[model samples]
Target chain A: METEGIYDVQAIRAQFPILSRKVKGKDLVYLDNAATAQKPLSVIDALVHYYSHYNANIHRGLHTLADEATAAYEASRVAVKEFVGASSPDEIIFTKGTTDSINLVAYSWGKSFLQEGDEIIISSLEHHANIVPWQMIAAEKKAILRVIPISDDGILDMEAFKSMLGPKTKFVSVVHVSNALGIINPVEEIIRLAHQHNAVVLIDGAQSSVHLDIDVQTLGCDFYAFSGHKIYGPTGVGVLYGRRDLLESMPPYQGGGEMIKEVRFEYTTYNELPFKFEAGTPNIADVIALKAGIDFIKSIGKHAIRKHEEQLLEYATAKLKDIAGLRIIGDVKNKVSVISFVIDGVHPQDLAILLDNQGIAVRTGHHCTQPLMHRLGIVGTTRASFAAYNTLDEVELLIQALNKSLKMLL
Target chain B: MNNHRTIKNIEQELIDDFSLFETWEEKYEYLIDLGKKLAPLDPAFKTEEYKIKGCQSSVWIHSFAKDGFVYFEGDSDAIIVRGLVGLMITVMNGQPAKEIVEAPLEFINTIGLSSHLAQTRSNGLRAMIKQMKMDAGAWQVNAENKTVE
Candidate 1:
């Protein structure tokens, strides 16, 4: 439990009640953390507390419940701002999830500023959520979409990315950590390079926000996006952190009750920063509960969590490497606790089914990175992503299950 | 009753075969074994033209009609899905076009496959069945045209 300095994974695992559940007569070994992490009891309690105690619409009435809900929701904004080291809470806009956040930028910023022959740069390591929005905007505006290729080992081609950046490059979006490959991209360097070309950078932090420590000012990124569920928070809530200046300059993403200052038959004025992007009533309960998740991470400390996950990744990598015919994808020097692999002559789906029967949950498919899979010349890979709660023993169980399943398949 | 007896007999055989396994694990192993024994499809027929949509995994199904009987050959990138395809082909292939179209495939439920498979896999299975039925209908029309000629 206490392997390293001040970190006890057993204590962390105890906070998450779902870790104790059994599936199919076997103890559940949840390894699908990248898809969405299991909620901690504290986060769940926060959700229940909100609905039971203060179930009212946010930013509306002068009633006590409404006031309580509004305060909690705004507190959550401050928590998120501190979590990612944003300059102010006003910079954090709550949306549905990471996909919704990216779509907001693509429509609001891209539609208003981008023009014909303008270029938007994204890496090959991006999930479809990060890719499709840019593609849609590019198609509409006739802006060219350029991709920074990745090496066979899943590291981005930095030289190619630098060459791709030019005066025409208006925007650059890259994944901070690949969901499928677990490769931690050098986003700071990417932002610096993109800035040299006078291009704004958006770091897709869907995978990194939970695993790594993020300081947006230090990174100097124009925008950062991540989902709450990827951390220990509830779904239907995410944060889109944009520079205050950029957000103010951009038009409103959606026109609704919360996003408008005033509306008339002749004209309409949008709300201030953050509210300009958040159109509707928003996922109030989930957003309020997200503070608990942020608090949960802060209490555990990001350094400790990162250390634990790094150990898991190293141990799993070594164990999986010993298996015959099993090839680990994306063996980069810097990565989170995610392992994607494929076995010769065994389809990833079949392997996933066998693992599920043994009560080990993993994701198998393109992982919404179909272009990445195509680039790697693989149909798909079975991905086992770990959270702070996952133990080395669980990794052992995974190894044993893979061995048994491989023997059966062979 | 004899008009569709072959399809019914094959479905019953599948149900009995699946019933041999006491646990889902053993059943899945059996399915994987069956998938390995699936008749290989022609490389040329593995194109996007023959690929079945609505499947999580890439699945290609090819069929042809000869002497009023429709034969199907199917393959999937996922082994478990391929096994499901093999099970379907075992029951419906080499049957009359009318029988292939009309057979309800009640054996999927009878064998407890419908309950066992995940929602996406179940949808994929239904898509395969629908595509096979469409292929049979098209082939039946072509056969009718030949008779007219």
Candidate 2:
């Protein structure tokens, strides 16, 4: 990936088939990137290629197609390992998506390590995927759940986090980037501090992995999880990276074929590092296409993509702040590409509808982070998230749509 | 607005009559007609300042108290939004403050609107209603304060 500002927005836009169409008679200006990114032709073609050429189950069979399938499947793990700068390919385990990955950790790690009266610390910035699983496990395990508070700027208080990390703290899970606020948390420092207290840390990288350069090994976090769809890959496939020793210490999340080493009548042995975790038949086609997504990101260059996104964020933030009665939420100093705001008199749902009629797509609601909504004293927000492919022209279209809606409503 | 129950009863009565329509298409036509019978909102009342945040369509709702009852008038840029406002106003407007506050909103299920709406839209509707109720509660408290004075 070159850092020489090779961001051809028009060329990038052409790669996504969905971008050419019209929604409600206007050109589709999709600003809902944080919800799910539009896939490029490379990722789509990879899916078609897998189904058309070698569509067979991986790792178990001896035939030619099986060998091809196994090679592609294993290659994705290698790609993900390299993408996140993991220590080994063995650390990358495949699952349905980020939600499933976090749930697996909660059940396997929380169930195994968290005892009665233990503590699990999370911050107010978590998506429900990171919160509810821990809540359910905490309830079942009789462990006390603690929450690190956040300031009005949507930044987590490290002092509060340090205070929360006592001897009773067994685990700490935090979002690397807040889905609702666009706040880029100092996860490396959080992980380092948590390690000082001997507590395992899990960083939810669903939003961060796409825009940020992640080196999980250097971060020293125990576990990291992310989804492929958010990174321009197909949905329903995700990666979970854990320390080799920690993964070996935990139990398997599910029981099924391919995960067993040897199943005897009396006893059963689990399979290797990743296979031990991927129990059933994986999302075969999607896992293969995920490698293509990684290739796309690498070809474009993470540094260049990050710079493009930062420019979009700055431009959109300035424009949106100009709208009357529109108060932007989570004014954190460090952020990714998400912008959440609320109009005083206009319901976000209404705003979304009006925007949709003009073929502008934006996410409106609590964004699956209801507890954060309560903390912010809002029912929901109108969220416009950017991607590498988004251009200044598209941002102008969004603003125009918003202006028209406000005029019609007011 | 001491006549919310009466309005609800009228809506139920209308639905009962429309239920006789043989097909869903016909039933839907009749239901929409029933919605048209509710009082029309004024054009001036339609403003961004009154737009309810969180709906897919642009909707503006404002209320004015007349004879101790809050009379709500709302307009929307979309037809479905207008219909939703009509449904809510049927159960909310023209009711005694106490009754309006305590009224069971379970009838929303019978109307099939709650189930038909997506979860996000449903939540927005709930928030709008909650805001209306809070306004009504404030009025009720003011009434008590005036009596005590």
Candidate 3:
């Protein structure tokens, strides 16, 4: 299980400058990777390079800097197109983040496609981003929002999901991985079942893209969305991979210059596929920098990174399971490198404060899934999410810190 | 409820007590103990109606006035936040409406736990302080109106 020699985790750690910094007079053992990853130097350098050298407005400028900037931005689209295995660059739409991407699909595609009394099925595992947009659109359209319930262990009740699908089922949007529990949903099966009912599926890959190999065509989901920041890239940038025909059919999310081809006093012709969805002056610097993140992942390979993280998850789970009062939530076979747990008689916030005092950073509370917390019958949990850069030593530190924090709390 | 000890006196006492603890470990351990020893709030007042909106952990604050002195009782699901609530009650409880309204509560910073109660995190400590002051202010206005009548 030791991946130390082949994975070169220290070398991976070296690429991230923030990894070496002290948080509270101690070396920062950042276990909040599921929240947002620390950027590698390549991603940072790409951001700096764009602003310093080719800082100009994109797609419209005739100047040299504009041409350079535009090319880099579009080149990033191709990188993302390849990253998600989209059929064409046109299917890869740049968005603000996963939330924004979901909103775009809901507002644009949902408005266009959803009918009265149609059902939009989402799961209990989804973050608010996947849940709320569908609810809003459903409310507006007088459509129904059906929830795919989870089992006691946080796995989606696939049989219940299958039963939930019917003639009224128009859309199936769910998280590929639970942000709160790190339980990987059976998205492929969900997609297949929903497709049988002719339901368009949107996978919220915000948590999965970092760990799994994504292939949009193979998965056959109509839309896939993930945030760049979660994948060691810059924030304010994400990708929404829609089927080309679906993108062409949907209305523009907003009325802006980039989204239009030609505007007249009476009528406006919208821009083609991806640009139609990209409404405003995009996060050009971050989008271009996102390409560097993709390249970094490609350089190291996700298999190697996943192997290293899986080892960390396994090690941490065993150590955490040894703690008497600690109970791990949703430790299914298909989970990623995230561990969510609650300890008896220890408030998560109190544990977080004490752990943070020892320079161990972990996420506390509902983790943006309040309903999931309600289902689990707890107010919140303390979650330690791993990344490619995290190590076994850090996991041991977390265990030691948890033990010390628990002593003070109990 | 100590009539001789003003809010300022309680503040000074808390500062002196917190000063004894050099590290956050001792400080937090003391806080957890303070939280546990804190009296359980009336179960009826622990509902959403008394709940403070800002905290990640649920906090409920209930205040009432008797004999022109405002009394406050609060509780939180999180022990650390409950400790903070206990501190607030110690300083503000059984004070005259005006005294409660005008209490300068800067001892939290001196105790080195200000970040836990920061307004940015929307921690219950800040919101509870605001609500307690507002309650005191309302009580003061009501008392003044009664005198005028």
Candidate 4:
């Protein structure tokens, strides 16, 4: 219980019961936060509460359970809207996850605005969710998909990005933080430059949402996308924050029960901003539970969490560098708490298994960013991403496990 | 002596050998050692053509038949996977192509590698097993055709 500087990490860790669990006869040192964070008891209870008390269809239901469910569901929307600093609750459109959120924008907006030969710019650091959706749309629209290259260190070549932005650049989709490398991209400069070309900008905040303070309004990007599961919330729920004007202008993402204003044999008009995109019954339990995740973040405050995580990151970076034959990719100053590294003579997959035996869960593979892996000139790197709950002691445990694992591997 | 052994005998031998190790660490160490000892595939066959799909690491498994018996030469960039490949080769190697194809590979369970390989993350090992069976099946088809001819 290192209760230093008003940031009680041990207290925070206590809230998540999974932290006390074990794997392979050892205490679970879960480091795979970048994949999906473990939910807090608060978030888990929200799901349980929803199912137990008021489990019913939302929006159109006239019954008491429906009213309670709808209230809780919409309350989450307002929470998300406030959480991301969107202009209004209408700006927050709930979807499956970041992938679904990005697809909503790419499918709806790209189909309407993209012309042949139009250039859509995406950085090299983007997750597959950010890249693939735009690529699909660009291909269908006969638009060119221009990629912003990265330096050997995995930092985005910002100057090259500036030169690429022009009247032809119809869209600029980039990640706030690289999930593969954890390098925070120069998205602020990117947004300003893309706006000069009148190109729409989308920030894939999937990796950044839980870590970075996200003020979508301050970001001035046309759209921001993130997943709830990454932020200690439930899976199958994500947010797409589009500017109200932009959201209203774009067509509905999916046409179904909730998305429709009226339906007749003649014609059917679509619903308003958020609901227009939220088609069908939506993930009722998860969406309501997502507010608890948001509240958990709000309770601790992002600044305190960020400060604590930075400590863990600094400690990890310094210690991981001490390991012989270990190379930290994208070891930049400005980054999140993720440490993606490759050790000589040891495959990342091998490290993943040996670490699991030691009860240390880490991510090993391309992390759904194969293009980035290709650029890095490696098969894959083992990543150990930290959450706010992660402590310096855990980082030391990681080092110890790595040393033990490497003994067998090397 | 090698020609006298059946696939069942080989599988039982593997289970017995693995039963000697009481701990997961010892089992993994054994697997890693076996992987290192497994015959390397020809560099030419190490290309995408022979590479096992769905593996986290690159695993190239080349199969051939000699005197109606199937032999497998496999290697993996990841030692654990290579070790799994080694285990597969141990069970099926030197068996008749028809027998190799028909072998249930129950030793994976008996040896306690089933739970370790079951994790979707280690899908490479599962994919490797499927590939071994498939390669042996191809040789079985060829042997059957030769009999028909």
Leading candidate by DockQ: 4
- Candidate of highest lDDT: 3
What is the docking quality class of candidate 3? medium
Q: Candidate 4 chain B — worst ten consecutive residues by lDDT sum?
A: B116-125
TM-score of candidate 3 versus the correct structure, residues matched by position: 0.97
At residue A317, candidate 2 shows an lDDT of 94
Flag regions of model 1 displaced more than 4 Å: A1-6, B1-4, B54-56, B115-118, B121-123, B142-149
Q: For model 2, what is the error of residue B59's alpha carbon versus the real structure, in angstroms, after optimal superposition?
A: 13
Listed in order, each prediction's TM-score against the native is 0.96, 0.79, 0.97, 0.98
> lDDT (0-100) at residue A225 of candidate 4?
95
- What is candidate 3's lDDT per residue for A1-410, written digit by digit as tens? 22345778888899999989997689999999999999999999999898889999999999999999999999999999998999999999999999999999999999999989999999998899998899899999999999988888998888998889999999999999999999998899999999999999999999999899999999999999999999999999998999988888899999987989999999999998888988889999999999999988888888888888999999999999999989998978889999999999887888888898899999998889988899889888999999999999999999999999888888
Tens-digit per-residue lDDT, A228-276, candidate 2:
9999999999999999999999999999998999999999999999899
Q: Residue A145 in candidate 1 has what lDDT?
A: 96
**Candidate 1 vs 4: which has more TM-score:** 4
A177: Cα error in model 4, Å: 0.6
For model 1, how does the per-residue alpha-carbon lDDT over A1-410 read when each residue is reduced to its tens digit? 22346677888889999989998789999999999999999999999999899999989789999999999999999999999999999999999899999999999999899999999999999999999999999999999999999999999999999888898999999999999999999999999999999999999999999999899999999999999999899999999999999999999887888989999999999889888888888899999999999999888787788888888899999999999998999987899989999889988877877888899999988898999999999988999999889999999999999999888788
DockQ, structure candidate 2? 0.09
| Per-residue accuracy of model 4 over A1-410 as CA lDDT, tens digit each | 22336787899999999999989899999999999999999999999999999999998889999999999999999999999999899999999999999999999999999999999999887788988998899989999999999999998888899899888999999999999888888788899989999999999999999999889878899999999999999999999999999899999877789999999989999999789998899999999999999999988888888888889999999999999999999999999999999998999988988998999999999998999999989998999999989988889999999998888876
How many collisions per candidate? 0, 21, 0, 0
TM-score of chain B of 2: 0.72
Chain A TM-scores of all predicted models:
0.98, 0.99, 0.98, 0.98
Candidate 1, B135: how far from true, in Å?
1.6
